[model samples]
Target: MLEAIRERYIFNKCQVIILDDDGIITLSDDHLFEVPNAQPIENVHPFFETIRHLFDDKNEEHVFHCIHLEIGDVIGNYNVIFNSGNKEQNPFLVLYDFTENCNYIQTIVQRRNESVIALEFEQIQAQRLQAEQVFKNKLIATISHDLRTPLTSIAGFAELLQKQQGTPQGANYVQLISQSATVIKDILDNLLGLAKLEAGVAETQLKKLHLPELTDYLEAIYAPKMQQKGLQFSLKKSAPKNAFIADTTRILQVIINLVDNAVKFTEKGSIQVFLSVLAEAATEPILQITVIDTGIGFPQEATEKIGSFQRFHSTDVEGSGLGLSIVQGVVKHLQGKLDIQSAPDKGTTVWVEIPIQYAAETATAVQTNSDASITLAPLKIIVADDNDVNILLFQQMLAEQENVQVIAVNDGNTVLDELQKQPVDAVFLDVHMDGLDGITTAKLIKSNKLTKHIPLVAFTATNSAEELDMLQKAGMSLTLGKPFTQQQLLQVLQQISATK
Candidate 1:
């Protein structure tokens, strides 16, 4: 076979050594090899070097580097050691000049490095995204939970007054109800602002708004807040002022957000609003408005963390830390520049600059249609979860539903027991657990004759397709992932109750 291969490629050469049963060279072609001086093969090296077979150990494969006849400078190399075992009789040693293809080794090494870097980069990217997702979820969770208390109280008071009317204290109760509703409305407004900004729905409505009028209007609006907090507010402008064309409402909102932040951070110090003309280029004119406060400056360590969701005053303030992100968003939508200046224990100064085009302002009222409906009917909801926070959140969200009541319990074990104890309208069950998790719980709930009629809504953390399929197989009525909104809960509950 080797002779045929050599014959086929006439440029190649071959040398073969055949061994006898006792490990002695029986015969060899010895082709193409130059004998420096004719002598026995054993004279050039040890007997093993010219031996018929290489290894004698029992169970392991062995290979070794062996020297072959040196060729010219180009083809000088060693053997690529391989063994076909002693099971066959005609074993021969084959030689190749690996120096001719050294690039293969370098390619292997390069590929190894590339693979490692790819893996590391993948892990880093995944961790970064995971961190972002976790941040988003935690923000939603904190906001949802925080907003629940006040909103529930407002809704409950409203419902109580609505139901138990016609008493002497009705007017006082009505006043209290109005106050609670107002607080809720304020919170809702802030939250809606943040959502709109983050979701990119907050767009610039360009119209001509009188700059002086808008600033005065701001003073009138925040006068009470400033007075209530005992903080002084002053407004000033550069001598040469230029009126601007932009979104009036959005600009007002941005100013209010900044002022509100100032008020929140500054307890007893003064806050000031200043407006100045930045520049006037051929294409556009620029205006700068700054909100300066002397309350409490951001810590040096947390200075950069501002305008992000994880930041809050003392980490204990009543905010979701989304205030500055919204501020940034509002500025971006208006083609403005936002910069912050602060010092520890001093105060914060936020500057917003807007560039307006040559066109004058056009203010047109856009009609908004809001449905006025009071959901006063009580709903019976089953709250299932192992976490106290989640269960409490669900209870609080359902607290204001007019005829609605929540049955809170941990785990699915008592679901059957609770079903037997009361006739609930709907069930909100969490998915992750031990010993009868959501799938098992759902299967048990759906299989039972009496409980099957109740809608089983899954509350989960993982939003994977396989997880959803598994939940679907268990016959759940709906899937509501964790950190869901209060209105979402109400909507889901209403949906099931409406269908029934």
Candidate 2:
């Protein structure tokens, strides 16, 4: 019977031992207990003595229950059940290993604790990020609003100075002031654009663009600067004249940024811009643009720094170090590639390739009567703006026009009252104003039968798509961004007048 019990327990990895009535161990499965050679249970295991005492009172059944034992560094959880049948046979002890179950439960608890901690950490980081984004957006809004009014005045007055007759030196000084103001405005615009792009609010609006007209505009704008710097500038176009379907504004921005960099670095060398169609396939037309400048070239190491807000030139040159970054972002948004090649003394060449989408029907350019050719009719216009500087700037710009009366209002309520009192041809509404906002005033004007036909043009510092859409829905006929040039203002006036 003892041999049978020992063999059965040994096969199942359970420790079994038989002890006589005198508390002496008679038999033990040392292998099951992890003992080296065959030894008695009382000699190897420390808990043997304590377990033997439980069978002293053999009158009833004795069960020692669960016991925890440590052998060297290993821990075990064991259950001891004693069998003393009728006092005729020696008592037997059975130890069932519960170590694996205990370890498994412990591992599950540890993993759960780690998961809970990680979840809490992620929640904290999310809340912190949201707060930071809110703060950044507010700062951008405040800066844009505060800087636009002064910038408008500076550029507006400088333009007026350019039109007047003066000495060559005086005219040159005026031109410099105007160019400097424009550069500042461009920097601010780029910063705002970057912010919008980061916030996922800006998008590309593609339209049909005439390449010839674009080249002409660039030549007209930059040729004078090149001449002033004693440098030659040229724009070349290849065959297979094509019109590109693209975001005209962003494309223009990219080209302008590249040209500006070239002009700033070049003193005596020439700058050449080439625009052409690389492949003439109807389905996938590719446009290649290259701007090559023989200027102060940068080291090869600088090529790696062609990303966000990085500059590779001296601090003496005035710039925000954001032009190339903005260009790269715009190119990526348009699904294009940009390549730069240069050496220390040699010039730099920037090549850009973009896919061209051709419209199904070739677009015809809009033809408007020249400003000098258009006969003016006596008209009354309202210029509603809260800022005194903006109002003065608008009045000065309009003073040169013939047979047009401009009335200024500081608030939205006055705008409504002025229209009701007098006959108005058009309303130039500023979107940000006290008492009532521009959108609300426009809605009111459109609702009234008397003034419903009058055209409403929104003047705002922000040209965001959402803002423009809102203005359009509120019955605005046109939208103009702030710090606009004199030519832009005149063009808008002419368009509205022709429609009227």
Q: Indicate the residue-level lDDT of 212 in model 2.
A: 86
Query: Can you write out model 1's per-residue Cα lDDT over 36-90, one digit (the tens) per residue?
Result: 2333434333533544244453223334443444432233344533333466544
Compared with the true structure, the alpha-carbon lDDT of candidate 2 equals 0.75
Name the TM-score of candidate 2. 0.62
**lDDT, candidate 1, at 2:** 86
Error of 2 at 10 (Å): 12
Misplaced by over 4 Å in model 2 are 1-177, 199-220, 223-235, 241-244, 266-272, 280-283, 294-302, 305-320, 342-347, 364-372, 400-402, 447-454, 485-500
Best prediction by TM-score: 2
> What TM-score would each prediction reach against the true structure?
0.47, 0.62
Query: What Cα-based lDDT does every candidate model obtain?
Result: 0.66, 0.75
Give the candidate number with the greatest lDDT: 2
Cα miss at 161, model 1 (Å)? 4.2
Candidate 2 versus truth, CA RMSD in Å, comes to 13.0
What local lDDT score does residue 396 receive in model 2, on the 0 to 100 scale?
91
Off by over 4 Å in 1: 1-103, 152-202, 237-243, 277-283, 305-320, 361-500
lDDT of 2 by residue, 1-500 (tens): 98888667654557777766665567767434654333444565678765555666774455554467776565677766776534577766777777677678779989999999999999999987986676456555544654665677667657666676586756775766776677677778887876775576778776666688889999999999999999999999773655557777788888898888888777778999998766556467766789999988776656555532242222112332455666777776677888888675688898887776775564434444465744446668999999999999888987878777999999889999998799888999999888799999999999999999999999998867888889999999797789887677777777777876
